[model samples]
Target: MSPEFYTISQVADILSVSKETLRRWDNNGTLIPERDDGNNYRLYHKSQLEQFEQAQLLFQSNWNDELNIKASRPYKMLELFAGAGGLALGMEKAGLESVLLNELDKHACNTLRENRPDWNVVEGDISNIDFSEYHNEIDVLTGGFPCQAFSYAGKKLGFEDTRGTLFFEFARAVKETNPKVFLAENVRGLLNHEDGRTLETICDVIDDLGYKLVNPRVLKAIFYQVPQKRERLFLVGIRKDLISNSEFDWPSPYHRIMTMKDALKAGELYDCDVPNSEGQKYPKRKAEILAKVPQGGYWRDLPDDLQREYMMKSYFLGGGKTGMARRLSWDEPSLTLTCSPAQKQTERCHPEETRPLTVREYARIQTFPDNWKFSGPISAQYKQIGNAVPVNLAFAVGRSIIKTLNIIEKNTAMNKKKCA
Candidate 1:
C-alpha cells in the first residue's frame, strides 16, 4: 500500500518552509502532486517527490557527520556510569569496542546486559572497580559522571581532593587505565556549577592525571540528530604525550534538526512508527484538562477558569509556566526528556495523547533503536531511557574521537619511522 497522505502543513515542515509558501508553489505549478481521497487535500505521493533534489538532500544530509567518519583503528573503550549504554552503543556503532561498562543502577546494568550479553557489564560502584587491569589495553575512557562540587580548600585541588565524588572515580580510572584519550560528559549546568570553580577543579584534576584538557564545549543535541533540545557539556582530554602531536576537531553540527515527527514516524530517524509500550498516565481529571491543550500549546492555552482551577496559586506566579500543561508538536524537537515524563515541574505530554510519553517513545526521542530493549519494570525502563544520551549525538562525538585517535596513531607511527 502507498504511504499515508501528508497535509500541506506537514509537507511545509518536511521542507522546513511555511504553508503559505507551499501554497504559492502549488499555484505556480512548481510543486504538484497526485490526488488521494474525497477531501481533495493536496496529496503529494511519496514517490512523486523522490526526484526533487531538495528531498534527496534532506535524506542524504540526514545526520551528515555521523555518516562520513574518517577511517580509524578500532579503539577500545572503558565507560564509567554508562547509563543505559547510549554513549557506549553510539561509540560501538561508530566502531569503538566497549571493553567494559560500569553502572551502579541494577536496572540500567540489566538493560545493558540484556541488549549485549557480550559486554563486560560491571555492575557496582565505580570507586571499587580496579581499572588498572585494562591499562594499555583500552585506548579511551569515557563516562557521564554526575557533576559534583569540589572541596576547593586551596589554590588548585589535586586528584586526592576529588575523592568522595563520582568524578574522582572517573579520574582515578583515567589514572589507572592511562588511556590515550578520555571523554567525560555532564549537564550544561556543570559550566556554572558552584560558580565555575567546579569545572576549573575538574580541569585541574584531569591535568594532575597527566592529560591535557581540550577547551570543553557544550553541544546542543538538536543540532546532532537528537530530536530534543538537550545540551550537554563534553570534557575531552588527551594524554599529554599525544596532545603535542595530534590535532583534534570537534564534531560539526548537522544542518537540520530531527523533530518529534522524525523521531516517532518512519520519515528519517527510524524505519517505522515508535513501538507501543508502557507509559505514565495522568490522573483522570488532569488528563481531561490536558486533552484540551493543542499540539505545541501549553497550560497557558487553557481556558481562564480551567487554568485557575488546575494551576491554583501557580497561576499568579511570574514565569510563563510553560511545562505545566505543554503538548508536543510534531515538527519541533522535543524539550529535554526528564527522568520522569509526567512530573509536575517538567511535563512532556505526548503530541496526540493526553498522558505522558511512553518508555518506547522516550527511547525513540533519544535515538535508541527499537530492538534495543530496556530491562526492569515500566517505570524503571522509562528512567533508563529518559536519562540516556541520544545515540546519534553520541555517534557524532564518537566520530570526532575516532578522528583524534587516527591523528594520534598516525603521528606515533611517523615518529617510530623517524627513529628507525
Candidate 2:
C-alpha cells in the first residue's frame, strides 16, 4: 500500500518537475504543502495535484493495456555507444532486431557479446567505422553520445562546426545511414549546457541533415517503473519526407511510483530477492559513524562532534551536502546511481546494511534483468550499469517508436502497391 501524503520528491517524480519548481510553486501559492505535525515535512495532498495534467494521466493510466504493444514488423536497429546492451536489451524486449552495435570499451563489448552471442557487436572507436553500407537499410539509428562543447565563432553553428566531438560522429552515422528515424540520448544537463547553446547547435545540425525533430523531452526513469530517480533526455528525429505519415508519442507513466523495496525484494518488479554479490566496504571508523545515521538520513543527521570529525574542515562549508553519508530507505526510490557507490559525496548505503550497494543491487536499481549477467571486473561492471539507460525505461521508449514505425511501414506498403 502507498502512503496518502506525498513528499516533495515523490510529487516531483510524479509530475516530472524539479523540487525547486515545487518550491517556486509553493511561494507563488499555485500549490502549497501542509506541514507535518511531527517533523514539519512539507506534504502535498492528492487534491492539490488533481489540477495537473501529468498527475491526471499518471493516476488514470492504462499501463497494463499499453503493455500489449507489439511491432508490426521486425524493425532493424543499429546502435552506437552500446554499453552493456541496456538499450539493445530494451529494444529486443520491444520486438526490434539488432543488426549492428558499436562501442569503444572492450569490457562493455565483452559484456554485450557474453549476453547476446548472436548480436553483431563491433568493438572499436565509432569514428573509424563506416555506416554507409547500411544506408537506407536501418529502420533506426540510436546513440547516447557524450556531450562536448562546440567552439562558437560568433556565428550560427552549422553541422561542420560540430566537428571533433562525439556528437559529430553520431551525426555522421545519421548522414550515412539515412534511417527512417533516429534517437539521440543525453544527460538532462544537456538542456542547459553552455547556456543552452550546445543543444541549440544540435537542433540546428538535425535540421540541416534534413530531419524533423520532435521537441526533446526529458523522461524520468521512475515514471516508467524504474525504481531509481534517474532522468534521461531523449531527442527523436524523423527523416523529413517521412514525418507526415506518422506521429511520435512519448511513453506514459506507470500507474504508481516504485520504491527501493520493489527494486531489491521479491515483488512486482522481480520474483526473487537480489542475490548476494561483491560491493565496496567502508573503513572501520566510517562504518561505525554511518551506523549512527539512520536509514534515509544524511551527514546532517550525525551527532555534532561526529559531524565535525567526519566532515573535518569541510564541516563549516556552506550549503547542504545532503548526499554525504546518506543512507537509502526501503520505502522511497533511490537517488541516482553513479559509477561508484562509495564515493564520499554520494554514499549509497544499503537500506538494511552499512556497506555500499553491491554491483547486482546497482543493476537491479537500473532495471537490468536478474539473469542479465554483467562481465568484467567489479569496477567495470559498476561503470557499465551506471552509464546505461535503464532497460525498462528504454523498452517504454522503444514501444512508442515502434508505434510510429508501424504507421510508416503501412504507408510505404500502400505506396508500393500503387506503383505496382
Best candidate according to lDDT: 2
* Ten-residue region with minimum lDDT total, candidate 1: 1-10
What is candidate 2's lDDT per residue for 212-306, written digit by digit as tens? 99999999888889999888999999999998777888888897788899999999999999988898899999999999989888999999999
User: Please, what are the lDDT tens digits per residue for candidate 1 over residues 254-312?
Assistant: 65567899999998679998889878899999999999999988888999999998889
Per-model TM against the reference: 0.85, 0.93
lDDT against the true structure, each candidate = 0.84, 0.91
List candidate 2 segments past 4 Å from native. 1-9, 16-45, 418-420
Would you list the clashing residue pairs of candidate 2?
A: none
Model 1 residue 163 distance off true place after TM-score fit, in angstroms: 1.2
Q: Each model's RMSD to truth, in Å?
A: 6.7, 2.5
